[model samples]
Target: SQQGEEDPQALSIQEGENATMNCSYKTSINNLQWYRQNSGRGLVHLILIRSNEREKHSGRLRVTLDTSKKSSSLLITASRAADTASYFCATDAYTSGTYKYIFGTGTRLKVLA
Candidate 1:
């Protein structure tokens, strides 16, 4: 399992602040994706970055990947209480001759109002 692990297992910040999370994996991946889950709801795809790309942005979200370091980071700017949720990093990697999508232990973020 090439499952990644998110740093700072939990985070808390005031609304309107910025939040950042980091993920590290053990294997090579073709691409990395970030997902957000609101409470018990399903995961919502936020951003994806291929190994060939260094950084990508969508709205208030920014994602950066460093294949050489087998790591990735997600940043949310001007975060709101509505942004309080669990953030996960998934990786698509070819392992044991099979391509697999693996998710990491998520980071629980709390944006206090």
Candidate 2:
């Protein structure tokens, strides 16, 4: 599949702790993006890193990409209970002469108050 794979399908942590999620893809991609989805709601874009970018930060979120390894990671610092949600990594890949956006399985995170 062209979609990426995220490690640690589920995670539980206390508020103020950090949550880290890793994603690994199989093929070349133009860019990678992270998203968060609350229960029964649509996904919200968190960050996007191009293939040329190595690292990026936005507020409490940190993202790193390693094209050599075809891997990426998302780190949420000082996580709060409101951060409980499922995270997904998406990539735009060229497939069958067309570019398609594929999403990873996902990582479910639960933050305790």
How high is the CA lDDT of each candidate model? 0.93, 0.95
TM-score of 1: 0.93
Among residues 3 or more apart in sequence or in different chains, the pairs in candidate 1 whose N, CA or C atoms overlap within 3 Å are none
lDDT of 2: 0.95
Give a tens-digit lDDT track for model 2, residues 1-113. Answer: 64789988999999999999999998888999999999958999999999999999999999999999999999999999999999999999786999778999999999999
Model 1's alpha-carbon lDDT is 0.93
Error of 1 at 23 (Å): 0.4
Which window of ten consecutive residues has the lowest lDDT sum in model 1? 92-101
Measured with C-alpha atoms, the lDDT of residue 84 in candidate 2 is 98
Each prediction's TM-score versus the true structure: 0.93, 0.93
Candidate 1 per-residue C-alpha lDDT over 1-113 given as tens digits, one digit per residue, 9 for 90 to 100: 53899988999999999999999998888899999999879999999999999999999999999999999999999999999999999998685989877999999999999
